[model samples]
Target chain A: MVPLSWYLALSAVLFTLGAVGVFLKRNIISMLLCLELMLNAANLAFIAFSSFFGQVEGQLFVFLVMTVAAAEAGVGLAIVIAVFRNRETLDVDESNLLKL
Target chain B: MTFEQILFILFAGIVVGGAASVLLQRNPLYSAFSLITTFVGLACLYVTLKAQFLGVVQIVVYAGAIMMLFVFVIMLLNIRDEDTAVDPNRFLVYLTIPLGAILLGALLYVVTKVNLAQPTGDEGGTVERIGTNLLTKYLLPFEATSVLILMAVVGALHLAKREKE
Candidate 1:
């Protein structure tokens, strides 16, 4: 056994990195990429727990998550492109039309 | 070290390195590329953890469909012509590095503290069982997801199509 804690610890690291990357990167697309990383981290934890407990529900949840991720990626990219169309910029700092 | 441990280390390196490059790269397109690497590592990890179905889905849906969507959007936006804008808060970006390390340390502490029951090995993850579970126990959510994808496709087309002024 590779130890369950190792996988959990790795998940935590990836999640934190994604969170920090969301703050560090100014581009909306980069932040979206970071979000995907975070999502993957969560998925990793789910899979780890499933394997540790020898259950099937976690894999099912992974299926739903992947479904949602696919939907989210499609819709999010569309929104990004829409915003770019209106504002002509991809940078988060530059696209602050709603800022008062 | 066991073979599983060695494989875990290899996948971990790929995941971490790919994630670092995703944020460090200048172009969003390159970030998309790095995202593919991360997904590949994640899928391998899933396989090692014995979630073979999810491992395949991670590769097929994430690395395949999601990345292609990202690349399509990157090309569609024509983001290359614009001069690369610098990150506004250089200090905070640097500060986040150590902060993230500390967070990882804290997480390691928490992980070590928890003791889960060892596997009983009664049920293993088989594709047929997953499919049965998807159809019976998770039927509602599975069907709902298909509907969600339908909505997403329609919404994406509506959102991205050039509106006639």
Candidate 2:
């Protein structure tokens, strides 16, 4: 039998990797991808809990989360594209126009 | 360990490995591909968790829709591997490593602390139940999300328009 703890541990590791990517990577798109990774990691945990606890609420929450993630990615990529058009580079360091 | 357990382990490895590759890769396009693999692995994980509807949704929405958008943008930008700027801040790297370690430590601590007893209740997480709950109990949030998506679409149009103008 696969233990729930194993799933939880895997989720935790994935989340940590995402956090590292978010913090270490300077590219806006890369950071956004990492953010998606983190969200999926959380979704894994939610589904695992739902299965372990035999409740549908956790799964329901995962559905809501997926919707929100899609919305977020749409808006975020739009912003990234806009920024890239003006700056010609996706590197965060070069596009500090708002740094007053 | 049984077949399901082995499959679970294989999927977990794929998910983690793909995510790590996304993080470590220099090319944005390569990272996008890795991310797609990660999504596929995640969908499989959802299946192992008994969320059949969610698993399909994960593949359809994330792997199919969202990943295609990412690939489209990456291709549209025509970002080359050599285009990336090199950062010389070794100190930032040092700082992030320890900070990430601390965060992971805290996460593990919390996970170990929780006593997750097996849940006993109705298998209420099916598509029908979710749809019913969304229309009835969580109707407001459901409507709110629709509004949010509408706003995002409008915002994206606005942003795209400014570039042409």
lDDT of 1 at B76: 80
Which docking class does model 2 fall in? medium
Per-candidate interface DockQ score: 0.71, 0.64
Cα lDDT tens digits for candidate 1, B13-66: 999999888878878899899989999999899888878778888888899989
Q: Candidate 1, residues A12-92: lDDT per residue as tens digits?
A: 989998988887877788888899999999999988888888888988898898889889999999999999898888877
Worst 10 residues of 1 chain B by lDDT: B80-89
lDDT of 1 at B53: 77
* Number of the predicted model whose lDDT against the real structure is largest: 1
Q: Per-residue lDDT for B38-139 in model 2, tens only?
A: 989988888777788899999999989988888888788857554453365646777887888898888887777656655555463578877887789888
Question: What's the lDDT of the predicted structure labeled candidate 1?
Answer: 0.86
* CAPRI accuracy category, model 1: medium
lDDT of 2 by residue, A1-100 (tens): 5778778888898999999988778878888899999999899999988888887778878888988898888888888889888888888877877898
